[model samples]
Target: MKKIIVLFSLALLSFSAQAQEIKWMSFSEAIAAQKKVAKPIFMDVYTDWCGPCKMLDRNTFSDPGVVSHINQNYYAVKFNAEGTEEINFNGKKFTNPNFDPNRKGRNAMHEFTGFLRVPGYPSMIVIDEKGSVKKTMVGYKTPEQLRADI
Candidate 1:
């Protein structure tokens, strides 16, 4: 019983120590934070039904090194490509005009997604503090690859 308790305690401590979470903010919040801190914006454009996007979340984003680097260097934003939420970006309002609430699998893409010109799922957009796009990376990238790209 004592041995089991010690092992359980060790497991708890290990889990806590490895819990390095990235501070993912909304698009508006990321923009707001950029204005204050002058850091570049890193936006993760994903759809709820995208498999690669889910993989990115489960793999690359979950890596501690990637989380630490992103948190320190950029204002991270998670934007749902097919979301219905209205967003005000660069003095313009964007929304998903064709969104169907009852639709399953795939839905209408958000206006902001079009504005960013995201070609596919699991896209990563990097914008400078001046609100200009710096880079647009498509598809899935490992933590090391993401760090190298950024």
Candidate 2:
């Protein structure tokens, strides 16, 4: 009986260790998906050069609980704050007109990033099913903090 109990516990531990990943899509995709099935959108706005952003990706987002909760509850989207991707939102096309390909470290901020008015790196923008901005969380957050806030 003790051996059976140990096996069961180990199985449960392995199950919990198998982390689910957040299905991160583009902003446009997330918006389109809302029409089919209304779900809150969670956007992670990060810059390539941001240290905290990388830390958040490694520590918080990789957490099994965070990944599972985000996948099940929100339409997760990842938008690079300084990326060159052109995005269409609310009938307006936003682009990074000032982006320099030759630049080394930091590039120009994307138009949509400025439009969102993100205060700093690693901002998590939560939009409602109707595409209205709900909350903007700035800075790095732990898994527990993210779960509580979202």
Candidate 3:
């Protein structure tokens, strides 16, 4: 019993120590909060069917330094490139007509994607403090590279 308790405690501590955490925030919340805090938006645009997207999420996005920097410098938003939700941004509404709400692993494309033109998997879109787009990064990037982007 003593050994089991010790092992469980050690497991908890190890899980808690993993640092890379991209924030989980809604688009509306990020935009509204950005109005108050004036921070950029760091969005992870991914697809459920994309393997590389999941890889980046599990690796780079899980780094402690990357999580800290993103949370501090930007309002982290996770957007599905093929999600079914209707996203209204800057007076425009974006949705997927072919999107099946009942479908698994597929949805609608964000209208913002059309404007941003990020037709790639695992893209990172950065919006400046004033709500203007600063840059868009695509594909899997190392934690070091991701830090530089911020």
Which of the numbered candidates is closest to the native, going by highest TM-score?
A: 1
Displacement of residue 5 (Cα, Å) in model 3 is 13
**Local lDDT at 63 for model 1:** 91
Model 1 lDDT per residue over 61-137, tens place: 99988998999999998999999778998899999999999999899989999999999989999999988999999
Estimated TM-score for each candidate: 0.90, 0.88, 0.82
Per-candidate Cα lDDT values, in order, are 0.92, 0.92, 0.81
Instruction: Give the lowest summed-lDDT range of ten residues in model 1.
Output: 27-36
**Cα lDDT tens digits for candidate 2, 18-108:** 6456789998899889989999999999999999999999999989889989999999999999998889888899999999999999999
Strongest candidate by lDDT:
2
Off by over 4 Å in 2: 1-16
Point out the worst 10-residue segment of candidate 3 by lDDT.
Answer: 105-114
lDDT of 3 by residue, 22-141 (tens): 677978888899878788888888899999898888888888888888888788999888776667777877776767778777566766667778969989998777657788898889
Q: After superposition, how far is residue 69 of candidate 3 from its true place, in Å?
A: 0.7
RMSD of each: 2.3, 2.9, 3.3
Better of 1 and 2 by lDDT: 2
